[model samples]
Target: MTNRLTKTLLALAVAFAMPAVSFAQDTCSNRGDLDEQYCDDNHDLTADTPTDPKKLKTPNTLVFTFTPVEDPAVYDKIFKPFTDYLSQCTAKKVVFFQVQSNAAEIEAMRSGRLHVGGFSPGPTNFAVNIAGAVPFAVIGDANGYQGYTLNVIVRKDSAIQTMEDLKGKKVAHTAPSSNSGHMAPVALFPALGVTPDKDYKVLFSGKHDQSILGVNSGDYDAAAVASDVFDRMVERGVISADNFRVIWSSEKFPTQDFAYAHDLEPNFRDKMLQCFYDYRFTDELKKAFAGADRFYPINYKKDFEMVRFVARSAGESFNRAAYDKQNAGKK
Candidate 1:
């Protein structure tokens, strides 16, 4: 089997591993969109902390990862300084887990192998609902939380100058669960006179960098990707701004969210959250993440309202059935 097929099979396997029925269905009065193993008693739309002490974890090591928006190795290096600081601050060994796909990352958290990580905006929904992820912070600076835009880009030499020009052309979307890469375009492009699957064939490049690189190499006639990822590539000299033109752009959306597993021991969870809140970004991290310098406080209920709106506008949900359906599409 090809590497792509292997990855798809792995994602499906993880999805199937999630329990179909709640273990504590008798206790949970509300679950919202969260999975069966989780509860949402506060109606915050995220999994609540387990009341059973036996279910709470206090690991000796904390596993951290960032969203797979680009090369995992790139972020592994970029995030090293912070992970080192986190280790000292939390008095625990911190391991930076490199995940190749969103599904793998979510599964790691759900399985209790991951302690804390940054999840991409789109997949944050699934992470919160299915993986018991509790979003608490976002990358930000003195101004506030940072945001990114969905940019439809094409080679400057390419004839596709407008959104409508993309009709019947090969266009790449980063992934099925990506916000800027796929969901935003599906919701916003129709009014602009371009529908993704209807106007052109939608191809999943699996990552924002791949989509941008594919467009650069003419493998794709156009690609919808996050502006921040595109900017980072140009800043790193991976690509030149002059070589590509953004045919269209959308409003700013929240960037990656730093979240922790909800099942962590309450005291340890608070301490870990404090460590994140108190930490500051290194100069290299600031440059790599568009000058963001700190993990700004946030809650999923308020911070993700716009994201939920976009998903709803596109007829998407964060439920397990939706996740399974999306994974099935990968096959």
Candidate 2:
């Protein structure tokens, strides 16, 4: 049933969606200081220069959202305090937008409809490349970030127990754009004597958390997921950490990233990124974040090296082409 549903969704996402390309610049005509290339300068390591810099106009209403990794409705409440704070900083009517799919989120940023939001670690590359999104900060501890690993897990008593044992078994991965959830395993599992979609059928469980739960419930033989999602599930009391055991874990990967539209007014970029660094986690923010207390500064060029490497190995070029290709199946 799980595999069938996943294939159905993949087929749907592929059929109706081709790929998203930045067709034109979302520039404003009446601006004096803004250049035609304002939408995207070469500062971002992702895309080519924008044709029109005038597209960098600030909206009267600053729209924001979180990474759509887990439940979307839950984060609307989780980010409310930050939304309230952003309104004060940008002097706009701030709203927490609960976007459904990664495609929609990219579209929002491209059309100047979305100002700032968070994209999960792997997908951040696409947002930067395809949607012209500028990544800023990430959730971190006192020294830096809350990094994660791609963990291969199975039930304690399951007959198949290791990455080597996963041959011909059912395994659940998250979205195609997911790193720890999909790309890591696809890149590494072959060395372990198993290959995804070849040795075992590849299934998209829609989310990392769902994949974890499916293993516990016997819906899948194993799952490849981000360590952070696994930890949060245990922290939320959805499942016991001990009930499951890790068979394999990849090298350290970067944490989730907070990004804004590339066309954001230059004057506001500093303030917005600063807002992410300055705002202390509110009581409710702390709860939504699963025990993480602060947002910290991270130089994307330096911090995202491992993430970029993993993405590249999966034939993901961190360009508009790869970004569009990955989301072509999502509705």
Highest TM-score scorer: 1
lDDT per residue (tens digit) for residues 234-284 in model 2: 766889998898988888887788887766667676777777787788876
Model 2 lowest lDDT segment of ten? 27-36
TM-score, every prediction = 0.91, 0.82
195-309, model 1: which lDDT tens digit per residue? 9899898999999999999999999999999999999999899999999999998988999998999999999999989988888889888888888889999978998999989
Each model's total of backbone clashes: 0, 12
Q: List candidate 2 segments past 4 Å from native.
A: 1-53, 287-290, 329-331
Give the Cα lDDT of each candidate: 0.91, 0.76
Cα displacement (angstroms), candidate 1, residue 289, comes to 0.7
Off by over 4 Å in 1: 1-25, 329-331
